[model samples]
Target: MAAQVLALLRALSGPEAPLEELRALHSALQAVPLGELRERADDLRLGPLFALLGPGSRREQTTLCVSILERLLQAVEPVDVARNFRVDLQKGLAHPSDSVKTLTLSQVGRIVESSDAVTEILNNAELLKQIVYCIGGENLSVAKAAIKSLSRVSLTQTGLEALFESDLLDDLKNVMKTNDIVRYRVYELIVEISSTSPESLNYCTTSGLITELLRELTGEDVLVRATCIEMVTSLAQSHHGRQYLAQEGVIDQISNIIVGAESDPFSSFYLPGFVKFFGNLAVMDSPQQICERYPVFVEKVFEMTESQDPTMVGVAVDTIGILGSTVEGKQVLHKAGTHFEHLLMKVGYQVKNASTELKIRCLDAISSLLYLSPEQETDDLLRMTESWFSSLSRDSLELLRGISNQPFPELRCAALKVFTAMANQPWAQKLMFNSPGFVEYVMDRSVERDKTSKDAKYELVKALANSKTIAEIFGNPNYLRLRAYLSEGPYYVKPVSVTAVEGAE
Candidate 1:
């Protein structure tokens, strides 16, 4: 391939612009060793093709010259060649024929892919302005190709930094502002630039690109909104990013769209991304604020958790977990008839079969309930917790046991915490101490040498011992033998085996 580019560069460099008109250059270019020209990139020069690109050049001549130029872009080896081509490509981008402009921008897009070439592209200030302006060109082909080029350039660190340095972000913001069709592509471009490195992402953040993305989130285009959500998720990955979005009213924006999702054509399609953003925002921002801002937020998320799409279910669960973490969020969950129960049922079902991350997230959501401050644990929250305990199904018990026995210390602790928390209530105390295999499950982990696991187990056992139903294990003849096993102390341990589920935490 490199040899081919080198050969093409050689053949194209002859006595005259050998081919009289640009069209001839096209045919001759067909067999040009593009691969070899790229190999000898250091020797490449655009001087020979300047006549065709100059004023008074025929359209066909310019078109063919642009084609060859596009080919020259392939190697990206010679930094100087890329630098020199930019001026000509910028000029050709204004050609009357859309095809010529399209080819020129496409080649420029390809050229900026190289790290070294990206710096060269950014070095010339005027060249940067021209490329950005082309994004909104009258020719649709030209605008789309320009956007494609911008996005491609953003793929590397050098190019992304160039984007920031060259003020291309302002150009993108202008395109998005004018209601231009290319705005969607610009959305995609920002997502690309921010996706690569922290520096690029921070550049987007500080530059107010996130605000543009949030506005795009409510747009009528499903794809545009979805892509914007993707960017929001990226922002939500870091603490400052999430907080920034929340303060920027991004959470409010998402909630509004979701509320109308059922009635709106595009909003429903935006649900998955909306759910994802909700979960992320709730991580640091107040889920209470989300519910307060959008009264229907909880209902929307509850409905989504039951959707056939597993992704919807996962994000719904995530948001619900965050909601349940706060008092206000729990109240919303508690008031939603059967939704809270449905969550427990759905989560219990998924606990055994779901990926480890899902399992842990579900567990964290449920566990958060147990540790709430006393004031937050209202009567409704307590009753809901107790009710969840009273009606534990066979699958639920199996799920609990499965979690209790997990090799991952965090998961085991999360599972046991639920049981320990339930045992605190006198009414639910009997159920906790007497639940089949519950105590032994605790012992299995409690007896382990790992201090965290052992400590969690002792906590579970202590809760059981505090229950009035301690008599059930200590006094009842039925539990007499089981009690003797327990009295044998921590050293009298039972061996347990773990089956690893892929992608579990």
Candidate 2:
């Protein structure tokens, strides 16, 4: 059996093996038990299989070879594959086909996930170099896969040392110096590895790579800073990353940059990221603390809401939504008092007059502002959300109902989302009952035509039916009507009854 498998693989070693032959080999290998294959691994001569994965191979051959290689790897010891197969795997990475490189990197990702395989992988310096080099390649998909594999390798202490404590660290630096795009890719990889744990983050910090990335955040190049801000935001997603930034005073530095951005001609380019970073910070940490600590961040968010630039307004609106999602965030925004009211007015105007995209964003922000989880349903927060809803206009419910009737499905769904968020509030439910057709609209199955719109309307009815306050607000009869709607799922169409009218052709 070993000799037979070896001869079949040797047949495929050439530039373009016969497609039918490759398929036959793949099927034959599938039937062989992994234990039997492992016993005969030496005679299997897998190098030829890896060769079929390289450039100049037909697509069908490449696909079949990948399948065969996967099965074969499970048979061969992972450590041996990591050690002896290094050169062939590097050839796959160097292959001209992005598909080949991606498929190869995926296998590498699998190998590194096993503890026994990582040391041998880390031992091969050239393989490591090839992976890092791929990060700067032309294909974004290939670059991302390379990034993922390298990040996985750095998950352990030994792997971190190999990447950061060795000459490969210098190689990474040189790659970054090649271009801003390559530099950001490296930055993204570092952020991914560092976010894993305090130990991994410590290695990244000690290497000075994290500091170098922060330096770019304050660099003279607005484009680089803009790109770097996103990476920094990614890093900030992890608690350890956020702690490192705070300890290094990076948050203060970002706020100062926002303050000075008004004078820069390129302010618009980077300011949104700067704002979003703070928005993320506010949610991750304490919203009130962040807003108070950096009043400039909040001020900038509100200012951008009024900007003529759609991008700026969109980010600002999103930030507002984030800040208002939590109880603390709501209090912080409510502390602004009249300023908060003005922002709501702008959002209402946008809902009525802005582009469909912006209008949906405005509705989302309103939904975020009005939402009250059952646990957080304190009297003060409830009143606060009610007041915010009222400030939208004299008749906020009527305005949203108008949006729900719009022909655009997205706007209709967004408008319904806002109602869903409002559904649990007793005050809002009272208003819904008082409004002439609003209750009927919520119950009307024919109102929403598409799946998404139907789902949105069902969610609204479900919220109303499930609310503890529903029976009290709308009498048991109306509440029972909502219950019936809830019993029928989103797509439950009522069966139509047809009776032939007495042969009246």
Candidate 3:
């Protein structure tokens, strides 16, 4: 069996190894006992597996190598695997094939996930160097994987020390020196590591990479600033990260950038990120406070809503949806009064006139704005969303109802989701009850054929049935019908009686 395994490895390493041979190798390796495989791990010469994953390898071959490698690596201690395959893995990282580098990074990622593997890779300066070098590779996938692996490594204290404090930090700096594209890739890795924990963030801060990245946020390079905006947004996802940004006045720096963005001709390049960063910041923290501190963010959002560019409109609409979803956020927009009113009208107009993709986004934004979870549904917020919904158009329900009847399934489902979001609201419920055939539409499962549409219809029915205000607004008969629809479930089909079927056959 060992000889057979060795033979198969040799065959697989061949330039033209047949697919059958690959399959056979996979099956034979699976049949090998774990203990035996471990004992023979060295003799197995797994180096060829990495070669088989090189460029032009068939999908099945690549997948087979990954599976086999995962099983083998899991059976043995990661330290031994690293010790034995260190040179091969390093070569794979430097291999001309992006396939080779990605596959190698995948293994390194696996190794780092285990506590025992960290030290060996950390101690191997050459191995660490190779991994860091991959971050600056031309291949985006390879660079992302390399960043992912290194980020996993930095999850530990020792890994953090090795990356930020040791000579390997110099390697990372060298990698960043390659170009702006490569430089941002390294910055991305630093942000990722920093996002993990306070201590990890401290390490990153001490290394001065975070400061450097923020400097570029206000830097002259439009492209680099655009890239940095995205990275900083990611950093802001964490509590500590957001606090760090605010305390460091990076939030103000980003706000200043957004204000200045309109004057920059290349503003189009980075404007979306700038808007999205504020959108994210608003929801993550206090919508009112962030908007107040950076009124330009809100001004830009509204300006974007009115832009002719679909991209700008989409981001603005999305930000509005996000801000409107929360109670505090809803109040902030509600206080804007007519500006908010005008924005809702704009979204409705988009739903009617925009492209299918934009229509879906409009519907999503509407859903987010109107939706209030059972816990969060206070009288004021409900009235606020209702007021916003009413302000959408004199016949807001009719607009979405017409959209619900569209041929496009995605558009139709998105419209139904908007209904689901507003189903519990007293005003929305009354409007539905008053609208002809609206209750029937909600009850008719037959209208929705596809699984997505079916699930969406079920959700709407469920929302209506569960609403505390629904029964009172809809009255008992219609309410009972909603409950019946809910009882039947999402995919229920009505049974047809066929007494004479056997005779007819």
Go through the candidates in order and give the clash count of each.
12, 0, 0
Assess every candidate by TM-score: 0.47, 0.90, 0.89
Kindly list the per-residue Cα lDDT of model 2 for residues 116-157, writing each as its tens digit. 887777878888998888988889999899888889888878
Worst lDDT window (10 residues) for model 2? 1-10
Model 1 misplaced stretches (Cα beyond 4 Å): 1-211, 220-224, 233-253, 263-269, 280-286, 352-360, 373-381, 391-399, 402-414, 420-429, 444-505
Give the number of the best model, judged by lDDT: 2
Give the best candidate by TM-score: 2
Per-residue accuracy of model 3 over 1-505 as CA lDDT, tens digit each: 6567777877764656677887888788777778877777666667677667666777777777767676666556667767778887887787776766776787787788778777778888788888899888889999999898899888888889889888999999999999988998899899999999999999999998898998888889888878889999999999999999989998888788888876788898889998999999999889999888889999999899899999999999999988987888888888888998998899889999999999999999999999988888788887888888887777989999999998779998999999999888787888899999998888887788799999988999999999998888999998899888889888888899867656674
For residue 428, what is the lDDT in candidate 1?
53
Off by over 4 Å in 2: 1-16, 23-45, 53-84, 498-505
Encode model 1's per-residue lDDT on 329-389: one tens digit a residue: 6666667666577667777666667777777777766666544443445676777776664
Clashing pairs in 2: none
Itemize residue pairs with steric clashes in candidate 3: none
Query: Which of the two, 1 or 2, has more lDDT?
Result: 2
2 against 3, candidate with superior TM-score: 2
Quote the lDDT for 127 in model 1.
63
